[model samples]
Target: MALFVGLTGGIASGKSTVARLLSARNIPVIDTDLISRELVEPGQPCLNELCQHFGPEILNEDGHLNRKTLREKIFTDSSARAVLETILHPQIRRIAKERAEQSATQAPYVLVVVPLLADPKVQPHYQWLDYVVGVRATPAIQKARLLERPGIDPPLADQMISAQSSDRERDAIVNEWIVNTGDLTTLARQVDQCHHKLLMLTAERTSSE
Candidate 1:
């Protein structure tokens, strides 16, 4: 079997940057965030279920997901958030697994980017991962990065950061850490190290088998 590695981090923690770096090195990466978005496209079963539960207001006039409206609803209501997760998380995991398996045909191992992998509720579902790497930045840095995004005010940015797993929590589960506290060059160097480590692990697994 091909080794499956998980890449995860909190909001604004540079997970995308790491994934991009890995892709640049010719690594095969299956990103759950992208899968989740695809799963909710117009006429998809996930979107249909979401409309049933959250109402049609969650969709824009063009039939795409009105993310802002859904975000406001979920952030204010825990039960609503739970419902959304219930409808989407399993589908995301299923598609991610499928893509990873397909990618494994061409790569020694597959990298799966799961933004919420450290959450207690989400962690159990990913036990099959052979390894997990976490990208981390200080809370202050996370807040600053979040606030820079369009439509992200101070209060919403803070709320989003607080809702994710803490650095300590992530550290407890991740096998490796990539600290993203500096410029692109610094982040790129760390990603290069991580890529080399993953290649070593993949070779070891292949030889053992």
Candidate 2:
């Protein structure tokens, strides 16, 4: 069986960066965010449901999902966020599981990237994860990185960062933590070390089986 390792962190904490590095090393990384986007594509059933509840304004002129508009609504409205999660989480979880299972057949382990693994709704779905890896950075670093993104102002950046698990809270749950306070070279080194450790663990598990 493939060992499932969850990779999660706060907003702008370099979870994607770490996942990219792992992918480059031939490790399978299942990114749930990408799967979520696919689920709401132009003709998907979830997109139709979203339009029915949130209205046509949720789509752009090209008839694609207006992610910007949806982001604004969810961030500013708690109820809207809750309702949207209600529609998307289950589908995303199902799809993610299917992808992870497929990936497992091809690799000894799989890294599942979930931005909100700490969220209550999301946490339960991933309880079966064999291990969790949390990428962490100081609040200042997180805020600065978030501000660099397009359409993200100070308040929204702060809001997004604050919405997820605290660094402390995440640290408590993850089996391993990667601190991304420095440059990419430093972060890469950390990722390499983590990857080596994961490989060792995988070898042990496979041998036992």
Candidate 3:
């Protein structure tokens, strides 16, 4: 089985950067966010369930899932959020498991990156190594990173970070961390080491098998 790395981080915290570095090394990554997006396609089972749970209002004029509207509703309403999680999490896990199994037979290892890896519940079934890789920047630095993304507003970005676990808590949970403090070279080096460690773990398992 491929080593399942559960990546966690706050908004604009460079999880993508670390994932990209690993991808550049030819390693496979199972992104839950990507799978979540897939499950909500217009006529998929998940879409049907969501429409039933959330009503037809969750659909766009084109009859596709209106992600924007759904996200807005879920974010503000705790019950809505719980209901959506109840609907989406299982499907996401199912897709992730299938991908992980496929990857295991094809390669030595694969990473399952979840944005909210510290959610305490709903973590993947794989023996996932939680990683709290992120930018150790001040609030101003974080705001700059968020605003530089073009469409993000400062206040919303602030709220997004505040909504999740603190950096210390994230760091405490993960097996390792990659500090993205404007030093891309250092970040790249660290990710390299971490990637090999993951590969080594997978190699060990492969040999045992």
Best by lDDT: 1
| Alpha-carbon TM-score of each model against the true structure | 0.96, 0.96, 0.81
Q: Which of the predicted structures, 1 or 3, would earn the higher lDDT when compared with the native?
A: 1
Question: Which TM-score value belongs to model 2?
Answer: 0.96
Report the CA-based lDDT of candidate 2 relative to the real structure. 0.89
Superposed model 2: Cα runs more than 4 Å off: none
lDDT of 1 by residue, 1-209 (tens): 56799999989999999999998888899999999899999999999999999999999999999998898888777899899999999999888888888898887778999999988899999898999999999999999998888888888888788877888988888999999999999999998988888888888888888
Q: Backbone collision count in every prediction?
A: 0, 0, 1
Q: In model 1, which range of ten residues has the least summed lDDT?
A: 156-165
RMSD of each: 1.1, 1.1, 3.0
- Report every candidate's CA lDDT: 0.90, 0.89, 0.72
